[model samples]
Target: MLKQLSVAVLTAAGLLLPAAADASPARFLDQSTIPDLQRAMDRRQLTSEQLTRGYLRRIEELNPRLHAVVQTNPDALAAAKESDTRRRTHSSRSPLEGIPVLLKENTDTADRQTTTAGSTAMLGSRPAKDAFLVQRLRSAGAVVLGKANLSEWSNFRSTAQIPGWSGVAGQTRNPYALDRSPCGSSSGSAVAAAAGLATVAIGTETDGSIVCPAAATSTVGVKTSLGVVSRGGVVPITAQHDTPGPIARNVTDAALTLSVLAGADPADPASAAATFPKDLRLDRNALRGKRIGVWRKGHTGIDQQSDRIFESTVHTLRSLGATVVDGADVEDISWSVKPDLLPALLTEFKHDLNAYLAATPGDHPRNLSELIAYNDQHRDVEMPLFDQNLFVEANATDGNLNDQAYRRHRAAATGIAQRSIDDVLASNGLDAIVTLSGLPASPLDRPGDPRFLSSTRNTSVAGYPNITVPAGFAGPLPVGISFLGTKYHDAQLLSFAYAYEQATHARQAPRYLPAATG
Candidate 1:
């Protein structure tokens, strides 16, 4: 079993100060999202450099305890200076000009920072280029503040892998409860946003990596339809499923980021069909007269507290003039827990990862086999918590995209996932479907049982759009409600989520409690 670090060990690297900050910037920066920060810059109340330094200081003072951020960009202040210059010259690049953002470590940056995906194996080497979305953010004048810690190898390393554990950066703790799991592979991205380390963050998901953690940490996560954002520079799980999206404190901020991050790229053919909406402004009345499918069957027995919040959310939707249709499920899509999904993921992981390694300019392991061997050689550091059995399985798979079985399973997965949502929407004539994001953060002391239900599975498998907005509290922890829609419905999903968010105003800034106690 993986050993849990003691409170002393957890706080050894830094002071365990209360999450409340008394710093001058905390008043202006603590709970500020993108628009709030932008307005502060526009009013000349804050400079890009000042804002960047405030976040850097927060990361330095607090990251030791939470381990939410892995490293700060050495030239972050310099980037912010450039943004200040642009703003002074009346030549701002985009709406995101001068805003700070933290990216999940899996995203590459051609700078002093290394993109290791929380693994030491890829350390000491810089990527030859920035990820496609990173380039977009830089072009929009966003300061690349730092990299956030995540589950090593995006939580695909071990079948028993813990959500926030990483060899490179021990573990990322929930801002709400330091001892709880930050439920996604994009743990750091969620934590960083919730802790006010950045105005926004970017996270990639093959499935629950984005929304799950966003839910657990009380932040907004958008899992754009596959190819809505390019997967070119991200480490892969499967080309069919991997896509990068934004995580922020609100739907408008997430939507704004998506507008900047989405577009076609030559490197990823899937983006050819991608389309983006120009207007991201949220209409608070967007839910009016909307027919919403409430999928309550999945989350009933797992957590009563979350279920109560879900029921309350359904009531809120009805009060907002939505016609809530109960009992909507994708019974046709049985791939969620089936054995066939693993083979498809394994086959694609080997093929896509090999291509990525070959293209990256480094002396790192060139493929899955070499990576597995690297882990075996460095067992003390790499395999202390859990072994790389998932890597082993992927390495053993016949890495052929053209193989008949591979093609069949991959096609079947996509088709089934798509049809599942399409049929539900068509039959019920629903605008969007709602469900609990997942269970609140689990305890990190041991290998916990798998969650019985998750809203991410159906939409993830179908390559459709999904958005998570903080619903309410499950006791001391946060819970989120998800909105799922058919493929290419990202804009509508965002609009709907935005409406609910504006009405409820449920998200709360984390208290950074030491641990739960009676």
Candidate 2:
């Protein structure tokens, strides 16, 4: 009788509450930030093992429906135990001393998890070694919980592809609304962090991968300036634009991840200029009395609801003492880049892919030719939507990355984007730019996203930094506002974003429903 009474008490507390919980819905743990978790660990309120067990158990119960996680580390528990030992020994390393972090599949992890980049062709493939940025993560004492599924080859595999579908990991369901899209190719990392699968996750972006998924999942993600975070060992779409960044449940945590991930690396030449931008926490209130340029274009494709939400975001920023200067006023602002974007992407894809394939493990169609042939053989599965259009177009190009045409296009596109985007900020005496993130990615029921118009493109094509914080929700699902800026302004960028996020406090956990559309 006494034991039965004790069991009932535990049930009311929401401690997983048995198979048929008699209490309210799973309250889970406190579901807070990395710093909060670290303080709790410091006070012995929670052990790393306890925290990790809760996450693993939540995955066992919830991921069957969400499909947000692609793989789990077999050593996760053992790592958690080691973290506990280190804590007891008074040797805590950093804020993430015992926190679990998930890495996008494209980021190499020299471990049990395979870096397949969410494609079956690379199934069983493992990266030759840990990517430089990934190695930095390990040094900060983060337990590698697992790898998050991403859009195949970071969404470079197909032109008319679904946002979250990948042959290796399948379609990761949107945690906020099951049938709705999570957006990608950082879909898994964003969703995993939003759904409490881990404290934070690292995601890569050549374009919209980080911001889109963050907006879709009610989290914060920073798409750092080129070279701020080393791109070595990460699967690439364009070496000129590719970068890895952080996705977390909140802006502060994302800022923390940014600090650890940014550094100079001998492996990636781009890192020569990346010796800074790791001090995001230094200026915690960068938004005070600062000028922020409001982007004039790229919100036209948004839904009506997101427009209203964006207006509120502007008001919120203004109230925080930011001078909101409007328009795309700059030198060469009219100069466009997409005319050469496809050519540059294709050329880089072929060269970079061949290098990555040679480095990683696998036994399947490799190289641009073999992959094209493989796509031809599996047309029903691979080409049901988009033809191997990119593959074919790329096949027609020169393998020479230094060809005159390739070099010219690369120079023109990157120059116009970088110069104009920065000129707008400089001319306005602005520290950053603000814009609606995009149409809160239309539902996932269809084959593709609803012709989404994202502002991250400018920063992406320009190789500048951009971050998205939870602006607020249109309904039950979340939306984000982007902060974009000049070259290597990663610290200033994070400070502005973190201040905005703290002021708004506008994040919530996903309800894991069907669709939030009205």
Candidate 3:
């Protein structure tokens, strides 16, 4: 009875705000999309400052409970004012002119906000400038609302670490059920988007960081093809695997955000040889006559709840004119048999991170060893839940790229992953592969016991493109279906995902409920 009363009280307090209030035509900012907001602004029914203030109000009301937003941009309103000025002058930059977007804490912005990756050791560390992607987002007129909390050090601190619990910001709860985990290292970004705290958010992925969190939170996540999005100012995990991508509540929004974020960067040599799409649009009939491979090889350990959604998704695609092939397996891919991923990441992390630190303008720890030492010195705060074993391991390793063993492992893994994906696509004449992105959010008490199979390994290792769209729910929690394609096939992948999303509008706004009753 007390629990029921508590829930009623919370709901009455406007925790589960509606999409539209019957008393006024002012649509809920949480329910408004980038284009929708722009239309409202153009119609004179809304202004950039008004929209920004609405979002800020929502953040102030819910952030304390969700812990999704680590900080709110103090200048968000001012930036929105500038956007309003641009609109008055007919000098709007892009479609994102007044849209507010949240960024993962690891993404460096040369503003007052700190880019700490949710670690105390790098709390006050400031970069001289915004990350290459941030520069593009700003140029396109998207306001950097603030940094979202992430798994400390992008979940690389320890093998037993919690996904969303950062040393600096604590744990970000699942907005749908506050007790459930918001998977990371993109936890806060996923939660923020799911809760409608931002128009869209950016999350960086070395592996499952972007997709896993989006799936868990019922948001759309686009893990772009390696080199499609520049990683110039993003804190390092592994340059070979790390790429910043978009997380949003729908496929179109994610696609729109990606359009702004994707491009070549001379500073990021990995993207130097990459191709960016000249045009991207949603075609509802995109799945018509397209052959998509169902990657059964990657479906191990999928829970019954998610499998049910996956089956329904397959039927939905078939109904929409897609030829779905089940039991499609990749040939010559030995990801499970190989131990090359961690080794490669360790090598690159030690080298890439130190280089970034050396370039950063701050008095913080400048190397992995110093970072490790800082954590030890601040053990109660930083290492309360998990130790820095991964840091120690990376620090001890000789990670020189010139080393013969390092080169061998990197080449071998990259080659195996790439060949496996290419061979499967060619053999099946498949445009893309579909699989369960992840299962529902798990309870935070046992953070290590993840319930679903992650589709991150193959795509991350192969440096290919993958996108996740909400498929359905496991009770109150969400499950996502992933669409993956060959390298530089981001457009095709997005089209496929967008088509599925249109066919099955599975995403729903989070309710900020206290817990999952089921």
Per model, how many backbone clashes are there?
A: 0, 0, 0
Judged by whole-model lDDT over C-alpha atoms, candidate 3 comes out at 0.83
lDDT of each: 0.84, 0.77, 0.83
Candidate 2 collision pairs: none
Residues 1-518 of candidate 3 have per-residue lDDT tens digits of 22332342244432233323231212244445678768766765567776676667777777898899998888888998899899988888988898889999999988888988898888769899999999999999888898899999899889888989998899999987898989889999999898878889999998889999999899989898899999999998898999899999888788888999988899988888888675788889999999988875546445777778888998998998989987676553444527876787788889989898889988799889889889899999998888988988888888798898888889888888887788878888898888888667878887534433457877888899889999998888988888988999988888888888888888777767789986
Compare the candidates by lDDT and give the number of the best one: 1
Model 1 residue runs over 4 Å out of place are 1-27, 332-337, 447-451
C-alpha RMSD (angstroms) for model 3:
5.0
Model 2 lDDT per residue over 367-474, tens place = 778878877887776666566577677767775788999888888878888877877877889888888776665677564333444467678888888899888887
TM-scores, all candidates, are: 0.94, 0.91, 0.93
Give the clash count for model 1: 0
lDDT of 1 by residue, 313-409 (tens): 9999998999999888655345453656778888888898888887888768887888888999999999987889989988898889999988888
Between which residue pairs do clashes occur in model 3?
none
Error of 2 at 337 (Å): 1.5
Task: Report the candidate with higher lDDT, 1 versus 3.
Answer: 1
For model 3, state the Cα shift of residue 399 in Å: 2.2
- RMSD to native for every prediction? 6.2, 4.0, 5.0
